[model samples]
Target: MRPSSTGAPQRQGVGRRRSLGVWLRGGAPGVWLSGGAVAIAVLMTLGLIGILAVRGLAHFWPAEVVQARYTPPGLEARLVLGQVVEQETIPAERLRSAGIALPPDSGETLTRELFKLGNRDLYGSDFVWLVGDWLQDRQTPADALVLERREWGNFYGYALEVREEGRQVAKGAAAVPELQRRLLRTRDLSERLERLEKQDIGGVNHALERLRLEGRGLELDGRLDATAQADLAARRAELEARYGELEDQLASLRQERRRDSVVLRDVEGRTLELNLARIVRAYQPNAMGLGAKLGFYGSKLWEFLSADPREANTEGGVFPAIFGTVMMTLLMAVIVTPFGVIAAIYLREYARQGPLTRTIRIAVNNLAGVPAIVYGVFGLGFFVYVLGGSLDQLFFRASLPTPTFGTPGLLWASLTLAILAVPVVIVATEEGLARIPRSIREGSLALGATQAETLWKVVLPLASPALMTGLILAVARAAGEVAPLMLVGVVKLAPSLPLDGNYPYLHLDQKIMHLGFHIYDVGFQSPNVEAARPLVYATALLLVLVIAGLNLSAVFLRNRLREKYRLLEE
Candidate 1:
């Protein structure tokens, strides 16, 4: 009886084993593992973006200014003031091991606070670490002001007096309001001065240089004559007159900029005079409401996006970097798109499917795997040293000593990135071309359409989305590439933008700033590490957004092309 019943249990066990084997054979384990890997990857990406967003966006928000009375072991008790940027708790034993004497009543863990003690000129350091036990009477004063200046980092103090031309316009807390009004006026004057110096006067200087070079060229060609000399002299006279006028205006602006000064007293009661013109902005963070803080955040974000950088690019705006990145990427897209599409078309449609063609395709694919820095080296050698030098010799002989085109600049940067991105485009476009139904081409040919005509009108339109797909990939890679750009044209700081109000607005020969390089500079090469920390995150987040924006635009165009041609395919 048991043997007959056991046959059923044996059969059941065998069935269960069979089911397990089926599950394993179906690749369920591998599927689960792959799914886990993808989920982890997605989480990691989101985490990175979320971290960047929080750290970057928070930098713009107005933090409450704290005034704490701190006393070291042997030092006199005095008011220590700043924005408390970070706080960490550590084991008391670890603090003691580090030679920091803990208070007798301290717990097992000791807290250390990082204060952004700005006012670099006065304090010699922008940050300080204080033991929590040493900090007493910590308070956020409503009148504690923060002055974001064009130089010397920042000032945290109480506004004591406002003076205009040695006369006291206001005194005590009342002076803070007057200081604000004067600061606005000074900022306007400074902006005007900047425009006059960078644009109006800078243009004149450029013209003069060009004129001198043209004269040299004339002399080299034996074309210089009394009439030419007279014309040159007259033009020089006109430029000189303009320069003098600008100089007078600049002097007046400078005088205005210096007419007002602010007297501020720090937490230690030390008084210092700051010129109103130097202050980019001022706010009482502790006094600010939610709306005021939000408005301040908006203004700061805008400044980061729109303003020219100052303080070794640790402060102010990254407009030049943003502009350069977009311009270079657009130029790269303009260049690589047609070349890549053409090459892909030739390989897929025109060229014979032979060993040579296969070899070329293999080489193109291998190019995508090449180290980016190798491309930088090639660009520096071939594009800059050789190609640019030749161009300079041929067309810019008049500006030989300066070597206008024979330098690392915007054109070479675009070209280098275009070269870097072409392989990606070629592969994408080739795949796209391969996906197109052969009957579409054959139908066009049967309808009396030439191969060229079919490609241009029908095949190409169908593949336009893929063309854009390739472009999207190209732009995403090109915009964030710092290595090739550093060798080609990128700089830490560029005084003038490549595109400006000058004739021949797009200056391909000009060295430009890039957001990727800017992030590198701010994050790694900054003089004030603590102060520059937030800027690094802000710039990085902005760069990510910019790349995303460009890619999205291309994606949008691709989707539109797909929609527009979907009916054609059907």
Candidate 2:
């Protein structure tokens, strides 16, 4: 070896080449490529979530209201009051082509500002675009108030005076405090009226409906005697009396609500008297300090989560949608788990394994690939029409024309998703069952246990983690599915939640709102695109958080089950 110096250099080069070839053969290059792909995917997901959070959360912050004197070409200068919501640059040539004049020294590009001019009642538009160069001496006024009204979008103006019963109660600085005080009183009155209308009066209405249905049912059964008719009449009379009392209270509240009003002067020197009862909340964004604005932001976020939808679901909170989504997902989980586990157990443990079993497994796998809408159609036909219609005829013949469970509703929706998700559970459970060591099952049977007992006590415990995995996957799927739900239950705005104080409080027969459907409705079906845009982002963000929370909980349960059964599996 010491005698061949020239060949030693060649051997060293050959050794480096061999090492490179071994690396490729060991699959290191493929592993590196796969890792790079996974990293890119993770980064994209994070970026999307970050964008959603920023856009959605910024909507709640109070923006400073500015007064701008804008002049258009060959037109008189006008005072504009609004919040600057967006800004962008455009080519001057594009503006010139659109018949918009540019200054002699204007650069190749021009800037434009989109102002949220939110007096929809007066202007018929909530937003306006102005050439930034034309806006002269923009000023933020301390007295500029933003009134979030219950109707006609938002109002931006200066507070002039507060009046009660056609008399001026306060003016200027004094008016704001008086206005806030009256607004609090009005809000309390509104909440009281809502409770009376939705809960007390609603309960009476429900009782009356049930009484009518009972009478009809008895009539259909040929069992409506004089005594039964008398009982129904008494119940109806009682409910009517309660309803009449609520009506009188509501009338009195309305009269009180009409007593207070506020005068607001726009930048154009026009005064409009707005009823204080119609305002949701009024705030002076330019006057607010950081602490006050933070509090306002928190309050707005809370209201968004807790309040009911208003303005055709473009405004107000989405509590009903959130409740419906969570309730439906949980119901689907409950319905699917047992049936899935039973089917998997039967197929794997009891059935003879052969070519027929192989064919059945292949069919089950194919079912997992079937379109979700197909499942929805099947659910509508089988669950809603066939089974529910039969039940209606047998037990609810009195409510003939008005179908209860026979129509699209929460129960049918849950069942549809359950069927769609069952294949995942069956496949996971079968894999888990197959993985258990044969020795363990034989040992349990040898220790004076029957085969069934051995399978239940020993085999299932070891397979619990896999079962949890399947359930978690099913939950993730069911929570986000929209198309199938559209056919079965989901609606845009459900005034009353399915789980109300009505009889059979878990009203599975009721149509329910869902977060997925809400996103669809707000994003595409909204009449006011600008007003609903930010809300769409906020709702979508909340939905992502909800899904993440559910998945995390399931993952935690799965980890716990794995830990508890680790030694048994070993």
- How many Å off is the CA of 1 in candidate 1? 11
Off by over 4 Å in 2: 1-6
Please identify model 1 stretches exceeding 4 Å from their true place. 1-35
lDDT of 1 by residue, 1-570 (tens): 346867888999999999999999999999999999999999998898889889888888899999998987767888888999989998889978888776688799878899998988998998998887789998999999999988898899999899998888999869888988888898889889988999999999989988898898998889999999999999999999999999999999899899999899998889998888888898999999999998999999899899889999988899999999999999999999889999999999899999999999999999998888899999999999999999999988888778888899999999999999999999999998888899999999999999999999999899888888889988887888898888999999995889988878899999999999999999999888888888888888889899999999999989999999999988
For all predictions, the C-alpha RMSD in Å is: 2.0, 1.6
lDDT of 2: 0.90
lDDT of each: 0.91, 0.90
Model 1, residue 440: C-alpha shift (Å):
1.6
Clashes of 2: 0
- Clash totals, every prediction: 0, 0
Model 1 clash tally, residue pairs: 0
What TM-score fits each model? Answer: 0.96, 0.97
